[model samples]
Target: MINTKKIWYLLAAMAVILITTVALMSNKKEVEKTPKNPYQAIDGAKTNSYEPVGESLELTTDDNVIGNKKAELIVFVYEDYSSPYSAVLAETLSRINSELDNKLTIAIRPFVTAGNNISREGALTLMCAQDEGKFSEMRNVILAAAKEGSLQEGGFNVYANQLGIDETAFNNCLTNEEKSLKLEAIMAEADKNLVIGAPTIFIANEMIIGARPYSDFVDSNGDAVEGLKAVVDRQLSAVGTKK
Candidate 1:
């Protein structure tokens, strides 16, 4: 005896299950297609929270630096000039180096992001400024321009005279293809390290992304400045403890 009603009920249930499975997989694909973050400048001095990504990343150095080349600790900064957080981190590291008697060796790895002309040009300007031995000063100049939202107006020239670099020379370097190509290589390096944002700091293979309070890095009120002072102190202490 063929049970017609039972067979029809079983077919309907299987169809429903199949439809639900397909719907679920389609939604999963959509979610995977979306980005977890929006590409935009971080608010001035405010940073997103990040967990330590472990000590597996490798970094490189640049001639543009702030502390002892042979310092026990080397901090590699993968930064985009137009990022407000990157500028703040720069100032924070400078303060840390000064406090530590310039014991921290800082390396700058330029990360030029797509669709950010200001950052691209700002980096180029800083490289040109580095040629005349005023890398830090001109970096501040470019950072100031970024803060004022005037990087696109060729505002790096605002500090050209201060460094004794001719306006024409600065402009030429700012638009130089050779320097532009060099920055491209550096950006590739950032990609090699899996860096996806500005102001990512690498210390002893450990990395912290975005901006963090200076206090978080060392001791005192976490309300002061933005950077990774704690990483340097902690690593130095660990080395001491090992000794």
Candidate 2:
């Protein structure tokens, strides 16, 4: 006579309410949580990223070139001097350039990640070297040293001295604010060109990402060098014909 059916109905309604409340609380907890890696970047790439670059970066002239400027083929790369893969891709590109007899005009530009003091300083030194017309020597020496150890270890100055760069002038120019603007411009350019990673290369409309091993590597374009060389040769032929 205690109305058993009504009691069951009431208990069932209470159970449903409790389940829904638990679910809502769980979802709310999830919404308020933050990620452990809260880095905010333009491209959202991780900080501490570094790599190698340049046909060598020439800071003195806006026109930094690695090969024939008037040539039909041009290779553009965005690299960091401290990245091993950048070094590898750079070596590959250098080999390809040499094999092609410097027909390609290669341009190296900065695309720095945050928290890299050496990269920023190295870039500054490279610009000074460009001013002194010693970009090649300083870049090679500093990069070699950077590959082995650090670029902010005061070695760039030694290389600059060895290469006969005006020590006082080079040192004085290191703190220029314009260099930061230039660095930002390079990064923006890379972003515009859809460069999301280090060691990105462009040949005509074709895009090459990362390093290409001579023997064991392959991509969508058949053989790396052979296919690339074919493209270069065709472009060279076309340029020669036009001329």
Candidate 3:
């Protein structure tokens, strides 16, 4: 009664503060409820988070293999020649093989996602190189070219000549019906395994779908683990235990 106007003013101010607080709380809840991107990778980082595919890739004698066949672990990689990610993976796997003391067998199969002659030609060229014992060399040349954006569909013969792959034999192999059949069979096998993209890797019956660095293979927390190396370690440990 003595100061009714002042009391009303104070009440109105308190109401405004309460409304603001409630709105802020509601917004915070909304933010907390939002989902995160599962495949979100760190910017500029070479490592990637992996999803587990609970299936094994059967290795065959016809598969283009690198590293020692007697290795305890076999890793199958399905890659596209025209994909930069596959190039990254080739480097990563090479490093991993070195770090692991050549304890891995890396089998490579081509999955032509680029849908062009360059990719198909590259794949066929690799098969030809394999016959000539120059698979690794030709693969390196192709990877380098792909990385540099200089890979040409019609330029495979130049690479063959540079690598001393017997130009005639390489050209004949490239145009061979048998090579085409083998590639088709490989593509069908990849499709059966649900390979959706390039650089898909299979280790210890788990599928990793992109190029990942060795560091990303393990988790920092020591409990939550996801990466190429992490899965490989687990498989190695299990194999050791079984032995």
Candidate 4:
């Protein structure tokens, strides 16, 4: 006594269930792919509404830092060396460091998610130079090399020699497996922080995306633009007021 209509209805219900399950899974994946704080179409500074990253954003003893390490205003920079926009941001940060003097610290957290060999290699170069206490010098040289497309030609050795880093040590550090693991850890840390792209900056609780110029730091009388400099100035002023 096979119930043909009942079997047909059962199959139809199963098919509907399967389709719904698949759709739910697809939606979940899309949601996961979306950044925690989705980027807005507007330019300039994007305020981060989340609490401070706490220990995750804190600088370690191994960090490549410029300016006073203990400065109240520490600008955390997560950048890929191969990115032109990151290079521009690097220049802007350096200028800010010089202009602000010891008012702030720039902590560079290098990552290689740029999807290129040059980015990975550049990070390794910076880390290797860091081992020799030459990170600041190597950072400038490697960024310039990345911008000029010279890193692809393997100019690290020449740069190392020029910068007075021990050539043998630098080469050994470059080939070390531990350095690669360290970089992977750095990338994972960035992912955990919801970093969606290179050159993501964390100034206080604010997260700024893309490259910003010094002028963008302040509003112009003729033109309107919000910039990093403005943000930094505000943070600095706040800390000064607190003190």
Candidate 5:
């Protein structure tokens, strides 16, 4: 009787131990198999991404004459000379402006997107033009020359001559330390704006990355007068609501 009792007690203890072990194993499996959020996974995947340089400079259309002063729509494009997409979009933007007839204003900010060398030189050239008060003309000439792949054909001197810019003054502007610092500032602004790619355009606050289709630049779908009326009404409403 004593031996049988001892045997029964041993079996009960063994069963309890076995049950506890199984429960622990099951709990571990459950924890390991639990799913994670898909959005979180995606965010983790994109953690290494970065923006371009020279994105911070506040772009303005005040210098440009194409767009309305109070126009709700403002388009900002970040471009680099080495980028083919930037070249194509530049041409397209020009056409859009002509077709729209001052309805849209495009503000351009130069950034080096492709690589360090081309972007640096391109930014410097733009700054030099700005210094000489020939920014618009020089910008057009460079874009045209870049499209034709003839920027280096005449070097800086020949290109300056073609644009009717004084070669000596232009060369001095390019080599000036002050002008170079300004260009660097522009690049730093671009970096701050988180511009990751070339031809990144912002229509109002809406960000459009890359060379978008021409249809993206079309006028509002609503009646033009209706849109204008809405804006006017909102402004008047705000005025009336002010304390």
Candidate 6:
């Protein structure tokens, strides 16, 4: 009778230990399965605000012209070559230019987003094309290829050839240190402007921060005149305040 009692007590203790162990493991798994906040995940990559204080800088190549210039209207675009949103914005700008009869002057600056996707080589290739006066054509080809999802290995070279850019010159430019520095400077300037994402558009002084619909630019009359007027008014207001 005493031996039976001892066995019963031992079994109860063993059962309690097992239950406690299982509960701890279950609680651990629940802790591990908790979801993370998406916005908090990107906290390390935020851009710092920078204002260009003097005369606007310009980058000129034989094929492309980019910079701060006085015009009836100035559209500043911050783009990343590997970003789909940027590609769409490029297409929209092309369409707008065609429909508006060249009423807008556009300035494009490169902002690197994808890790080593739009590299120094890519930027130099663009600059070389600009030197050859084939910047727009080359840009269109690249954007179209990106839209088609074809920018794999050696694809940029193929597109350059398609746009009639001299492949040898492009290759040389891609490896040139001076050209690399220029691209780095452009990227730094983009960083200074607090460009946090690809396809950030600035019309006059107003900023539109994403790949929004083209219709966003149209007014009630199905024309972009109102949009242009808004930009003009903002610019005038800025000038008045400066004085």
TM-score of 6: 0.61
Extract clashing residue pairs from model 4. Answer: 216-227, 217-230
Q: List candidate 4 stretches off by more than 4 Å.
A: 1-56, 217-224
After best superposition, candidate 1 residue 53: deviation in angstroms? 8.1
Give, for candidate 5, the lowest lDDT window spanning 10 residues.
Answer: 38-47
- Candidate 2 TM-score, true structure as reference: 0.66
Candidate 3 — which pairs collide?
A: none
lDDT of 1 by residue, 129-236 (tens): 888888888877777666666666466676788779999888888888888888888777677666888888776545667765577443254543334666667766
- Model 5 regions lying over 4 Å from their true place: 1-70, 216-243
TM-score of each: 0.73, 0.66, 0.72, 0.74, 0.59, 0.61
lDDT of 2 by residue, 1-243 (tens): 889999999999999999999999999899789445322221211222123222333323464677777666666777766566676666676776788888888877655656776666777787777777877677677667656665554556777788887788878867778766777777766676567667676664445566545334344566324333454455567667877
Highest-scoring model, lDDT:
3
- Write down the TM-score for model 1: 0.73
- Model 6: per-residue lDDT, tens digit, 1-243? 469989999999999999999999999999899865222111211222123332354434321433324446667787666666778877776666656566566787766664665533455567777778777777777666667766664457876788777778777777788877887777777666556677776664355566645542554566443233333344545665877
Q: Per-residue lDDT tens digits of candidate 5, residues 207-238? A: 44566544423334532121222222333344
C-alpha root-mean-square deviation, candidate 6 = 9.0
What's the distance in Å from true for residue 99, model 4? Answer: 2.2
- Deviating ranges (above 4 Å) for candidate 6: 1-70, 217-243
What order do candidates take by TM-score, descending?
Answer: 4, 1, 3, 2, 6, 5
Q: Which regions of candidate 1 are displaced past 4 Å?
A: 1-18, 27-61, 148-150, 217-227, 241-243
User: In order, what lDDT does every prediction score?
Assistant: 0.72, 0.64, 0.79, 0.77, 0.59, 0.62
Return model 3's CA RMSD, one decimal.
Answer: 8.6
Runs off by more than 4 Å, candidate 3: 1-55, 217-225
